[model samples]
Target chain A: MDKRFWVLLGLFLLMTAAGLLLGEARFVFANASLICLSCIGIQ
Target chain B: MAFFARFTDALARLRRAPVQLTSTLLWNSYFLAPWLKNVPCPGFNCYSCPLAITACPIGTLQHFIIIRRVPLYLLGVLGLIGTLFGRTACGWTCPFGFLQDLLYKVPLPKWRVSNRWAPARYVIFALLVVIIPFIALEPWFCKLCPAGALEAGLPMIALQADLRELTGLLFAVKMVILALFLLWMMVTSRPFCRFVCPLGTIYGPFNRLSGMRLHFEESRCQHCDLCRHVCPTGLYPPEEIDTAGCIRCMECLKACPHGALQSCATGTSCTERSHA
Candidate 1:
C-alpha cells in the first residue's frame, strides 16, 4: 500500500473514534427516525 | 479463442450477480427493522423508502450541516467505504444505480452523453448537497432528488392519504424530474450517476486510492473498442481506467480480448500475474 492509503485509513479511524466519543449514533438515530420530508419535498 | 473469451465473459457476469444481489438485498432490508435504521448506509438509499434498511448518508450529512453540527458518523462511514472500495458502492450497492441498470436493459436506442457533462456532478455535490443546505438550512438535494421522489415520496403518498393531500407543486416538480430521469435512463446509462449523484461526487475521488483498483497493461493493448462497447457508462477504459467516474464494475476486464485490463488490490499483482 502507498502512503495515501495509510493516511486515509488513519483519518477514517480517527473520525470513527471521534464519532463514537461524541455519541453521533444517537444523532444518526434521530435523523433516521422520521422520513426526511424535506428530502422528498413533501413538507 | 472466441469461445474461451465468451466463457470468461459469462463467468464474470455470473460472479458479479451474487455480489450485486447481496448488496441489493442488504440495502433494501427494511424488514430487518429498527436496529438497522440507526446505521447509515454508504451511498444514497433514501431513508424514506419503506424497504430501506438504513439511513441515507447524504440526507444525514444535510441534517447535520443544516443544524450546524458535525456529521462525524456519516463522514467516518463514508470515508471508510470510499477508501476501501471507492464508487464500487455506487456500482453494486445503490438501489438507484440498480434501477438505472435495469432501465438501460429496456432495448431502447442508447445514446452517449458527452463526457463534458461529467463535471456537473461535482457542481451538484457542492451546490445542492453542501452549499444550499448550509445556506438555506434544508436538505436541498433531497427536495429535488428523483431517488427520494421514487423511493420515498411516491410510495409514502400511495400508502398515506394525508401525504397525497399535501402533495402540490413541489411534488409535481419532483415527479416531473423523476419522469425525465426515467426517460433519460431508457436512452442513456446511469445519467444520474454521471451527472447528478452527490454521493458519487464524494466517493469518486477515492477510485485511485481505494484498496481495489483497475490495472491496465499498455503492452497488451489491441486497440479494439470492446471495452468501450461493454462499459455501461461508455467510458474509454484505457484513458479513464482508474478515474473517479469508474464504478469499478470490471466490465472492461471481461471485455478485454488482449488480457490487458484487470482488477486487483492496490500494490498487488495478483490479478495481473494470475490472469496474464
Candidate 2:
C-alpha cells in the first residue's frame, strides 16, 4: 500500500477508537477528539 | 443606463473576488448565519445552530423534506446564489468549504480517490434529500453535519445552556461520525464534499452547465498535464466536467499557467474570457 494509504488507515482507526472511548465521558469529547485528529494527525 | 452598468460592473467585481467580502459583510451585519447570533457570518456558520442569525439551507430543506412541505425561503436562498454564480457559491461563499480549506492547509498525508468514487456523492444526496427525512421525521442531515457540529453542537454545548439539555446519544453519535470524517479528510482530500455532502450534490449537477464553468481554450493546448495534475478532484478537462464532483475550487485555474482555462457561462465562445 502507499504511504498515505497506511497513514490514513492508521489515523482513521485511531480517531475512531478515540471517539468511542471519549464519547462515553462527555459528548463534547467526541467532537474535540475529531477536531484534533482532523486538525493535527490527518492534516 | 450608465449608472446601472457601473453598478453591475462593481457587483461583478465583488462576486469575482477570491474571497467574497459581501458574504462576510452580510453574515456579520445581518446575522447571516443564525448559529452565529453573536458574530456576523462568523464563517462556517449554520442556522440550526441555536445562535445562528441566518438559516442553513440544508437544514431548511431537510425540515421541509421531513414535513412534506416546500421551503420557499430556503429554496430562494439557494436559487438566489445559483442565479448569480451557480456553484461559485461553493468556492467563494460556503462556510463549510471555507472550513474544509483550512483543514486542507494542515500538513498531512492526503489521498485522492479514483473517479469511481464520485457516484457515492449521489448516494449521499439521495439519502439526505429523500430517505433520511422520510424515516426520521426530522432533518437527519443536520444531525450528522459537521457544520452543525462546529457551528451548533460545540457552541451550544460549550455554553452550557438550553441546547445543552438537548445533547444525547444522537448528538454523541453525530460527533463521533464527524470526527472520523474530519480525520479522514486530513488523510484524504474531501471526504464530505466527495461522499456525504447533500449541499454539494444539490449544486453539483447545476455546475456542469452553469453559466459559471471552466472554459477550455482547445487552441491554447500545451496539454502540459498541469491542469489535470493540479485538479484536486482529478477531473479530466478534456471530458465533460463532472460538476457534481467539482467544488469549483479553482485549482486548475492557477495550475494552468498557459491561460487555457477560464470560468465562463455555458455555450460561451473561447475568443475572449467572459463571466456569465
Candidate 3:
C-alpha cells in the first residue's frame, strides 16, 4: 500500500531467494531432524 | 447499549477461541506424526517437544550461529510473517502465549509492572538470543527459557524413560525458571511476552510497518480508561497501539465504549471514511 511496505516486501523476497540459492535450505532441512536439546537446555 | 457491548465482547472471545485452538493443534502436531517437522514455526514452539510439528526459530537461529552458518531460511520466514502481521502471531498463535492466558484466568490476585521496564525484552533479545549464542556457541537463552522447559523438556522427560535419567543441574534450573514463570502468569497476564520473549522482540519493531494495524479515532472523545483496564498486558491502548508491546489481542476494541477503536488492514484509519 505504502512505499515503505513495498520496499520491505521487496527486500524480504530478495533475501528469501538468496537464501534458497545459497543452499541454506538444505542446512535447515538437515538440522531439523535433531531435537533441539539446547532449546530445552538439556545439552 | 450494555447488552450490545456485552454481545460484542462475547463475539470477540468466540472469534479468538477458534484461532487459538487451531494454532495450538498446528503447533502440537504430534497427531500429524512428523508431517511438518522440517518447517520452522514462526512462534516459540520448542522443537524438542514430542508433539511439535515445526522447529523453533530461535533454536534454529542458535543452531546456525553455532555452526557458523547464516540462518537464511529462518530469517526469511520470520521476516515474511513480521512484515505481514507483526506480533499478531504471538497474541493469537503461540501455544505458550495461550498457556499464559489460561494461567491468568486462575482466580488469583493480579499485579501490574511499570511500563518503563518494557524495554527489558529487547535487552533479552540482544543478549541471550543473539550475543550469548554467538559467543557461547550454544543457545544460552534456551537454557533459561521457561517455554522450552514447559513444552519440550518436561514433556519429553515424562514420555521417555531415558530422558529422565539424563536429568541434572541444568534440567533443575530450567524447571525453576518455568515454575517462576507459571507463578508469575497467575499474578500477571502474558508476563513473558511483555518482558522476556526474544521472538516477541523480533516481531515488535514490525508493528509499525505491518499491513494489519489497530486504528484509533481521536474524535470520539471519552477517556474512560476502560481500554487500559481491559488490556491484559497493561498497555495504554491509544498511545501504544502500534508499539512493540502490543500483541494485537483487540481487547481494547471490545472495551471501547464509544466504538473508538477498530482493527484495519490498510494503513489508513477506516474511521476517516466511515464508522467501520
| Each model's fraction of native contacts | 0.65, 0.00, 0.55
The digit string of per-residue lDDT tens for model 1 on B7-41 reads 33343455565666777778787766666876878
Candidate 3, residues B131-215, lDDT tens digits: the string is 8888988889888889889888888788878878878889999998899999999999889999998898889998888766666
Arranged by TM-score, best first: 1, 3, 2
Query: After TM-score superposition, what is the CA distance of residue B143 in candidate 3 from its true location, in Å?
Result: 1.4
DockQ of each: 0.57, 0.02, 0.51
Error of 3 at B38 (Å): 3.0
Q: Which stretches of model 2 miss by more than 4 angstroms?
A: A1-43, B1-45, B161-166, B240-242, B271-276
Off by over 4 Å in 1: B1-14, B273-276
lDDT against the true structure, each candidate: 0.80, 0.54, 0.77
lDDT of 2 by residue, A7-30 (tens): 533544454355334432232222
User: Which residue runs of candidate 3 sit more than 4 Å off their true CA positions?
Assistant: B1-14, B271-276
lDDT of 2 by residue, B242-268 (tens): 356766656665566676765554444
Query: Order of all candidates by lDDT, from best down to worst?
Result: 1, 3, 2
The DockQ for candidate 1, computed on C-alphas, is 0.57
**Alpha carbon lDDT at B94, candidate 2:** 66
